[model samples]
Target: MAFDYDDNNIFAKILRGEIPNNTVAENDVALAFRDIAPKAPVHVLVIPKGKYVSFDDFSANASDAEIAGFSRLCAEVCAKEGVGLDAGNAGFRAITNAGPDGVQEVPHYHLHIMGGRMMGPMVLLRD
Candidate 1:
């Protein structure tokens, strides 16, 4: 599938500072913030400052610095939020949903950090 960046997307607006967010951490290449609709006790989102429709798109198009910075910011945010390795072996879950099947609600690529409690299996098994 072709990945196109949409300037009008909500994340793009947030990156542009056109919309305010509950920012957790931010650097030159990325921003981390509390998810408005959190699925876990500690839920945060890390997004690239640039336009990226999916993880694949970001990984393929973004510069090495951008990729590295974005990754570092994700770990930094998780640590700052108290879900770091010190929190226990469970650590935290950093996930990115891609495409329609993944239920990606936004067009921009983002990582969701979830922790602070035990999580169930990634998917439900159907008979």
Candidate 2:
């Protein structure tokens, strides 16, 4: 019922240098790396370095600098991957899941940057 943080999560380990990651970009507040099981051409996982359970958690508790840094890092990822609208590219998708219903596999605040092709429907309608 609480948005608790797990320091031993994979992302946490990656941040702690316990696990290796193909880093794309990073700043004092976050780290962006290629996903191990990528679902798209540019599947980068951007995670805040702080201990937060979800986006809401990070957004609510993070300092202004961390928020800004994380956002800038996300934009950097899109730009570096050539998926931003500033380019002639079609663009990319940024996804963040929370809790069980959202199917968040990790208990760390993170954003998934997916692009390089049409992603189809955002989600299939259950109807």
Candidate 3:
């Protein structure tokens, strides 16, 4: 579905307490919630608290602290969810689709972290 970009994105609304979500984690700079449509058992969408139209927008507007916070938050969430670093040899996949051409259904920049089960290779449309 094409994400609504005119109004504040759904995720941003969620962040602003204007909407509800199955939140998994939250920090000053980001929020993590379950994907409405999950591709894996533990699929969560990690979104920046700050609103950005797209990945490119985020890249341009995000500060070093924002970038570092996002990186650390990913690791922290993965560990907390026991998705990759648990004793079970389980692993996780983190994905972020950039633009419409990249399959980004949402205009808001977010990261998808999937785990609680093993996943296949990173190749897309490959044998």
Candidate 4:
């Protein structure tokens, strides 16, 4: 399946140096930076430097090295932000929204790492 990647998206722009970000950590395959509109005290966004529309798109096509590098970068961000289990307090939440149903604001594949406080329930029960 073809993944439609918009080169003009915000993440894409950030990757191309068209926009600036408070970079937390970065490597050859991914970049981790603070979120502009943070929902948590330590809200960081991790995205692949390569073009990807969503999690599945990345999972289906990312090279093994890309996956390893991206994962390592995320771990580095967590440690840098003091939000990982080994860092101190409680752990952080790693999230990735997919499509419209998931309220994905950006078209690029990214992970949101939130912590620094009690996050409460993962999702409200919709009954």
Model 2 agreement with the true structure over 6-119: per-residue lDDT tens digits: 778998999889999999998999999999999999999999999999999999999999999999999999999999989888989999999997889999988999999999
* Per-residue lDDT of model 4, residues 31-122, tens digit only: 99999999999999999999988999899999999999999999998888988888465899999998887878788999999998888899
lDDT of 1 by residue, 1-127 (tens): 5557778999999888899999999999999999999999999999998888999989999999999999899888877988899656467788998988788889999999999888788887668
Q: How far is candidate 2 from the true structure (C-alpha RMSD, Å)?
A: 1.0
Q: Between candidates 3 and 4, which one is better according to lDDT?
A: 4
Stretch of 10 with least lDDT, candidate 4: 1-10
| Full-model lDDT for every candidate | 0.89, 0.93, 0.79, 0.91
Q: How many pairs of residues collide in model 3?
A: 0
lDDT of 4 at 4: 72
Reference-based TM-score, model 4: 0.93
Q: Say what the RMSD of model 3 is.
A: 3.2
**lDDT score, candidate 1:** 0.89
Model 4 alpha-carbon miss at residue 5, Å: 1.1
Please identify model 2 stretches exceeding 4 Å from their true place: none
The candidate scoring highest on TM-score is 2
Model 3, span 1-127: residue lDDT tens: 3444535667767877898899888777888888898989889888887767666677888988887787778777887788866556468898888766677866788989998776887866845
Q: What's the TM-score of each model vs. the native? A: 0.92, 0.96, 0.83, 0.93
